[model samples]
Target: MFTSAIPSLRWLQGFEAVARLGNVTRAAEALFISQSAVSHQIAQLEAHLGQPLFRRVGRGMELTMAGEFLLDTVGKALDHIRSGLGRLDTYLDAQLLTIVCPADIAQGWLQARLHSLQAQLPNLCPVVSVDETARYVDQVDVDVVISRSPLQQAGLTERVLFDDALVAVCTPALAAALAQSPQPGGFICLEGDAMSATVGPHLRQHFAGWSRRGMFDDARLLLDAALRGLGVAVLSRAVASEALAQGRLQCWPGFAPLPNGSLWLAQAQEPRSALIEQVVAHLLSETP
Candidate 1:
């Protein structure tokens, strides 16, 4: 077994800044230390490595072969450290718990319940990001992901919110008008960059014969289109609940609820902070 010598972080940092700037003075300025301090740090680092890191070339300094090797290794090490620290910063700011999910959920479900959540946890800072792509679980920076897809990532925990029960809906007037003839021109469908797999095929299978006037990715836009009597739209019951209850949109009869994977609240199993646990509990409680 081989053991590598460990160098001081301060020495490594000084060497990296100097190597990058190619000037001791500039590196010292950047590091906010005296030029002598920077030179001393580099000397200490080179002494540990048993090699000369720089050679005098007129008024300037050039990297030796050993210096080049060290530069490459140390540069990467610094970058990795910086990246890791950035990610750590995200975790440290426990005041905010970021919830990443589909736009439909943001607009239809979470947005409405946001105030209630804030009221329940006054100190809780929740940041909601709308992923039109609906791949929030795959985003590394996301703290909590509400996914319609199954949580397959290793070391991640999931809690099922509710099974997807979707319904075809349009304005009451449109439903009444289209009852006689549910043509292609009276149907709306999801097209590009659709967030969920459940919507398109389910619509096609059930309303296969219904004519489609347009296709879109935005659930809110689709809902708006339905409200304007553009065509019937297939939407998750939770997303369409408010519209249905208020009579803004009415469910078209003869279509039973379409089945899909249950909505899942997913988070990393390890590094489970109390704040994250609190937010997860709140979401579970709010699930209908």
Candidate 2:
């Protein structure tokens, strides 16, 4: 445990100013204080420390050995204090918006739209956090949240981003091969409580005989495996949309996707600032 024996900041400021300028009048001018006030503060500090920090040399002040040591430490400490205040200012900046969502949503949906969002709001600085377990909008300090399920918290406005569906997707070559005969490759599975519950029955009924090539906790990884021709991956339609449009992966025919869940965009009903409202509006305008 540390004792509260430290001197006041005003006294330290006076001491530092006097030490640097080497004159009481100049130090008082720099601090916007009377010379008497600076002199009083220095006197109080020296009395508190039980030692004279400065030596009177003609008309100017000179630091003693102890004063030199204290100045070095005090200068660094003041710099750190200024730096911490600067960081706080950044957090309070209106243009910095933080958006939180699941890893899959960040990678598949939000990441692509971020560039356009920034283009619209040129001063906007977005901070995105990929957290799968963040279910509530108030659970973290974020301006917006993209969730698969509706957040039941109060003081939040939610909009359905899209109705998500699970689709079986694979490379064009793999889809072509499966059209003629059952492909030799296994099924890439997304392993999570909710995802397993959704995809488990589908896989058992459709491709029970196929082996398991890879099991991933992230839908992004599952999509990547399918793109690499590792195996047929059952992933969210939104996750595979870009790839399907680009013709990198083809939807397996005869396997109609099942409605899995709805993706929602949620934010505080009373936003921190009007800038947050504009950002959220921009996001909604871009949503399909």
Candidate 3:
């Protein structure tokens, strides 16, 4: 079962780690080994495969053409192996679904509706992960992910959860002040993030003449700023519902809701489990 002519799995593991992270030190840290060890493993792997797998570029490393080919094949193998191993343990456990979501959406929407999930899936012991970068959803091997942007990975089942809407709102006093002046940069603005990409165009379209008195990346914080009368803010309906109902803030007149597409729920298609199916169904039916 062993041969010197064949490369070792340890070498392959090291190669995969290095290729994914593009840093030998990070790969070593991920593998819980010394950087020197990772470098040695990569060297041995290259020697065995008879090809240069990586090349130094500026301050970092880039995969070679050979490296890309190996990664494309090796990466799928690794994912399959990991998924298989994960399925061997508690795969059918109703309480074992792991859900990944964006931070703002989690704080604004999912947190409020968690009780509904509990009521419908009493056996679900949900583990929630908040990843704004969204780089490691597949690597973490989550059971489900609620995403504003689709991950678009292969072998994933996509389901529409709900559509999102953004509206401009602020305290009554702030609204009155804006009505008086309506100068450029007079509103709170969100820039440089996924939420900004989704809502920024709508904001400029509605308040083309207004100026930004404040800028925020977090929608919840933006809502708070709006509540304190800092400036008018664009907020998702889910995040602004309570404040609007309580009369804490009023909507800016003449701005209608802008559709932000459906929030998608995705999971691997194969190795399907009843637990995942049931929970997804519950989320679809009970999210009102």
Candidate 4:
């Protein structure tokens, strides 16, 4: 309240533009204001300081020596301001999105689809955050969000990515062991509590009497455990199909590739940022 130094942001803005453009008309257009208004503000500002800031030329204005000195200071300050805004815009645009998903879904679903997403959205760089036991959507701070949710919120939009089919999977060695021995305990099931929440109850109801020895949150982790012949894991066709085809994963007959893992990509409902909108379009076409 007792400060001797106080400056106006609008005056600085007006002064900066008028100095750079050397014309009130150009300054007004750049500032989105009327030429007469800019003139009035400049007049008021100069009057308050009791100094001449601009000299009138033939239908134009030129910076005075005092204005020249102030211009240097103003230019530096404005450049810094513009630089800050540029950085802020990138952060908001998700030039890179930190995608949060269950560890396995990131590996099985998202990672598999990354090449397609990258191909479609050449500018997008999505960073994956592994969180398999996660229950809620973790993209409040990130630009793009891809995950399954219980329901859509008021400010977020949801797109159906794919309908995933679950099937029990095992490594070739484990499949051979099952083919030879075929006993309950011999079936070293990959234990994962995370699947139970996302795809477990359905497995329990449909594919009964498989050994539950291990639990995992992400499909990639579960697949890895199964690949090592640790146990069987209930995973989606999207997650298991390639592995199965490559002979790394084998399906147990009659399990029916139980229906679960309804994939959804959630994003802000309003689509505030242009980059977010592009990501939504790219994700819709991404195959991973």
lDDT of each residue in 1-288, candidate 1, tens digit only: 212778999998998897888888989999999999999998888878887888877666789998898889989999999999998787567576778887787777777666677787788777788763544443345678887876577777877887777677889888776666645435775574233465556666676666667777767887778778888777677777667767898887766887745888888785445777777777787776
Question: Candidate 4 overall Cα lDDT vs. reference?
Answer: 0.69
Highest TM-score scorer: 2
Superior by lDDT: candidate 1 or candidate 4: 1
Off by over 4 Å in 2: 1-6, 15-37, 54-77, 131-141, 149-154, 180-184, 193-198
Clashing pairs in 2: none
Each model's C-alpha lDDT?
A: 0.75, 0.81, 0.76, 0.69
Estimate, for each residue in 143-259, the C-alpha lDDT of model 3 and write its tens digit. 788987788888887877788777778898877776687354367756552246656677777778776788877787887888888877777776776677668888888888877
Report the poorest 10 consecutive residues by lDDT, candidate 2: 132-141
Candidate 3: what lDDT? 0.76
For all candidates, what are the clash counts? Answer: 3, 0, 7, 15
TM-score of 1: 0.61
The candidate 4 region of ten consecutive residues with least summed lDDT is 185-194
TM-score of 3: 0.54
- Candidate 4: tens digits of C-alpha lDDT, residues 1-288: 223354687888998999999899999999999999888888877876778889999988888998998899989999999999886666566566656665556666567567666776788777677653333333334544556653455566677777777677777777777677756532333345334575456667544676567666556766777788887666667767567766888887656665666777776666555776766676676544
Q: Is candidate 1 or 3 superior in TM-score?
A: 1
